[model samples]
Target: TPVLLPLSAAVNTYAVPANVLAAPFVPFITVPGTFAAVISTTLPWLAVPILWCCGLAAACLGLIGRAAAGFPQATAPWPEGWVGWGLVVLYVFAALVLAWGLVDRFRYWHMVLLAGAAAAMLALVLPVTALAPSRGLDHWRVALCDVGQGDMLVIRTQESAGVVVDAGEDPLLADQCLEKLGLDTVEALVLTHEHSDHYGGTAGVIEDRAPGTVLHAGSADWDVDAEVESVAELPASVPVYRPQAGEVFEFTRELRVRLTVWVAEAHHAEANDNSLVALFEIADPQLPVGQIGAVSHPLRLLAMGDMEEAATASLLRRDGVPPGVHLLKVAHHGAANGGTELLEATRPAAALIGVGQDNSYGHPSAEIIRTLEAVGASVYRTDLHGTVAFSLGPNGLEAMELR
Candidate 1:
């Protein structure tokens, strides 16, 4: 268990307890399930009752697992890499030596030492309030949700309203992220492309939420009309717009945020190259009385949906990269095909890559990381930091990673 702690990204605190509770049901499920599977070909009718019993037992096990997972501090984050492994090894060795000494000595002080050791272990697994991202984040403007192997970004427009980009692959994860942000209304839902990873979670965003508008790439290859009609949750009253290049969409006057479509035409053969690229300009709020004269330039974010190298180069030649981009949603999840020329042209202060952990495709390539770092751009990946949020601080843009 000590060795596994450092190797894993997180440790399930209640796994042992959950397993113990589910022990009795294990045989009822596995034994019957195996029997049902073996006899199904020749004696299918006889296997019906056995299969039903197995299903019931499986459901009980699932309930036990879910209950355990719902507890606070049910999972605790563990540091990744060689350092964590080394630390765990040293701690385990020390613990073993201490235990041996306490048992041999048998002194009254040994009881106090044992209790202190147990308390220390508990502290390691319990939740720390200071590290929680929900407590103090009133000025957060941009949030990149960690939806594994997909993209989802939320730009705050009002107290309870925001603009959503890319719905991600999983509805539950997307909905959870929106709930965390306290968003009641989606001012605009932008589906950058037709890919499932980008638009599969549309139901999560539009379900029970007041969406003012839906913007998407109306490509002939994929019928946006049929897709939108299929989503029963989307109201008939809401308008869907297919924005063209050079078109600018502005929010309410009070909220100084505007989105400008830079690339939307299907110039390339690849669907990814035909992605809708946009620039978000959010005006900086007035600084507090004490912090006058601080640089308050509007936050400029360039979101390149999934354009590959050829398309990115074409866009660079056509429109050129926007100046002083504060944050960049790195193109194509930081794949190598997401050219470096754009990075050099934009030179954003920070780069965000939305990708899954241990993905087989080897996304967010090392070459891409090097290019961003070379240009002095601080790179943050969803695979590493989980959900990353940026807010305008007194000095400049500040980043907070919610793991």
Candidate 2:
């Protein structure tokens, strides 16, 4: 009832000639000198050519009715040159090797040897694809880590670690950023928390660096602890400290950091509404704390970990925010909750938002940008620009936005 397929019909498979196929992969193929081609090519040079030859031989032999596992077809009839003869000799050598195994005194060994070779090939492939070096950390200081569509930042001092905040939806990229900081450690991993975006990489940082501690609003989550332990190393201990209402944690007593829990119930309905807002006093280590006539010390980084209107209201209601904080990691990444009134209350010189590009949850809204500018804050976004870094010293906050 059905018409039979024609045996003589070509499959219409067009094979690439050897020279054309090898051209792109092997740059040295164009070199005039034969020795140059041999020397310039590395081990990778053998992969494409060998696989190409193997597949061509397998396909052609497989398609033939009785030529399964047959030898590869020769290129063409022999030319006058020795090159053609050399290829023929190589083909003959291969044929002889195949014949010896097939018609051997110990015939069973051939199949066993073939099976052993296949097993070895499989063993090599699995490990290569699956395993990566999970041991020693890699040095990649100043990396533009891919924290998904947003940003998470890290800066390493010789003795301490400084993290700006999180981008979102990634712990891996954040860990890689710390890994690039050249030390397998983090002294401090700060959280502006409760939102998945602000603290998304917390577990990654803790698991990878096992940092000394984390500073947060005291309402931070511990849910990802189990998940992080499953994939990465966990901390020996990471305590979250509630920075005092107006007290300072002195890198030095005069050059200090003061934290305030600013929780305004109506403005920030979420837990992010209860962030720990900070006012930092900076001084150039070089300039003896007195020289600049209270130069306000030097570098001041005011960090408000994802504070919404509720937290912002608390700060606004409180007193004693000096002239301003020098380097400010923006609240809720410049969200509407971070109203213009909040920016005026803190009066930061520069602003940084740990945000990502094309994130599912729209962040760093236009309203937030307007608020920051109204306070004369220079805006730096991690998602669009990359990792942003700042150095605090007598000169003030020297910022670098890494692309």
Best by lDDT: 1
Stretches of candidate 1 off by over 4 Å are 1-135, 288-296
**lDDT string, candidate 2, 71-95, tens digits:** 2321111222353244334434444
lDDT by residue (218-289, candidate 1, tens digit) is 354777757755643678789888889889988854456889998887556788887888899887445544
- List the global CA lDDT of all models: 0.79, 0.50
After superposition, candidate 2 runs with Cα above 4 Å error: 1-160, 163-168, 218-233, 240-244, 252-269, 288-296, 320-323, 392-395
Local lDDT at 38 for model 1:
98
Residue 108 error for model 2, in Å? 77
The C-alpha RMSD of each candidate to the native structure, in angstroms, is 10.4, 21.0
In candidate 2, how many Å is residue 383 off? 2.2
Highest TM-score: give the candidate number: 1
- What range of 10 consecutive residues in model 1 has the weakest lDDT sum? 128-137
Give the true-structure RMSD of model 1.
10.4
